[model samples]
Target: MVQAQDASEEAGTEASGGDEAAEDAQAMMTDESAIDDQAAREFFTSGSNLYSLGRYHDAALQFQQAYDLSERPALLYNIYLAHRDASEHAEAAVALRLYLEATPDADNHAALTVRLENLERGLAEQEASRVSAATAAEEAVRQEQAERERREAEERALAEDDKNIIPWIIAASGGAVMAVGVVTGIIALGLASSLDENCEPAVDGVRFCPSDPSLELENKQSALSTFAVMTDIFLIGGGVIAAVGLTWGLVRLGGAEDDEDAPTVSAMCGPTGCGASMRMGF
Candidate 1:
């Protein structure tokens, strides 16, 4: 700090003089130039040492610093050499182009041009390799997406089949029960009607049932009572089964398709026979 203050005082005294101050200023400028040259030399030596130690990128930076201090186009070519040794072909190409721009009339222009062409070719090959790798990655992603969609579609199809199976089974069971009930009921009615003339009402509508008290008549009446009770039981049971099946089917279908139409049921009863029917609107 003391030396810097003394130097400033000396510069102020020199400036106070006339020709002597101007001469001193010129000498200072000369000394600054020499210092810059010495600093540039130090940077250049450091860069050479680093390069010999196989630090090509560091060598390139050191050469760049030297070129900045000296403004020498030859140093730009040295930067290109360091970058080339580091396998940075694109950077080497850029440095060579800048060197050509800085020293347009250099004697080695043809040689630099050949080297630049080689570096540019290597850069182009690297770009093509990257593009090919990117395209392959994109194709792999597309195939993976397609496979995922296909699996999802298959799963959805299986789910739909599962949803429909319950309704199908219920409908088939209801149909079978209804058919069996109707056939058995008709046979029971026929057997009961066969005794209509023989069996008559006694007191308070109690049946005499075969019109006389003979053993054969009593047996016929018992058979008639049994068949009548069985007819009612089977028909009522079958009706309950069919109703349960239909209700369950409708409920399941409604859950499956909330936006779709529902099924309709119709029934008719007569003296000879009774039956029901169903229809789906959608």
Candidate 2:
């Protein structure tokens, strides 16, 4: 009988221990719930303050935190409100759906449903406009690039044509001047022949013969000297100009062996006559 009584006392002690454990668990849960409620209240207060300050994005974040802390449908509605006010229709729609799911029987279900539909429609339109704008901008850039390339090609072509024509023009001008010189030299030679014939026997004889004294012969000799000097000037100048043009043309045509060297022209006009020389380098 005493052993039976001791067994009953052990059972009684076990029961008392179980009750204390249950009490401790309940207290822990209450503390956790209180902490969560305090966190939710703080988040909600911050969210409201942000909303009042017109900081919708920050307000949305704060509201999202409050929902995370307490999982309250009302907090989600506040998040939706913040997102809508911020013009973030996509996020607002998502928040609205969550609110509807959490509280299907909420009194404002009809109003929220209408709001969500409007947000969805706005989201669709915004997405369409963004896509259209992107396409137009890309096309504009492509056209601008094409126009720029065409302009550049045309300018290059014109420049290349100028480069090709300049040398030809110089060469033609030089040839014309040289022709003039040749013609003038022939006339001067004829005049010299007449002067010599008048002086004496005109076979390679240019010395003044005292045997024939005439003022007309002296004047003809003076004219011959002037013509000879003029002829030399034209010939030398023309030859230098022609050489410059030909050298430039050959260099441009990539036909010159030593294109690195540049040709130079020099002129001399002494008491005797005018003459020109070309220092052909390379």
Candidate 1, residues 54-167: lDDT per residue as tens digits?
Answer: 999998898888778877777888888899899888888898999899888988888878887877888899899999999999999999999999999999989977866755
Candidate 1's C-alpha runs over 4 A off are: 1-33, 175-256, 259-282
1-282 in candidate 2: lDDT tens per residue? 000011111112233655988766766777777777777778788888899999999989988887797777778888988998998888989999998888889888888799788878888998999999999999999999999999999999898879666767777788888888898899889888887676665444354744435567777777787778878887888877887888777777774544345467788877677877766655
Q: Judged by TM-score, which candidate is best?
A: 2
**Root-mean-square deviation of each candidate, in angstroms?**
8.7, 11.1
What TM-score against the true fold does each predicted structure earn? 0.60, 0.67
Candidate 2 regions exceeding 4 Å error are 1-32, 49-55, 105-111, 190-194, 201-206, 209-226, 229-233, 236-282
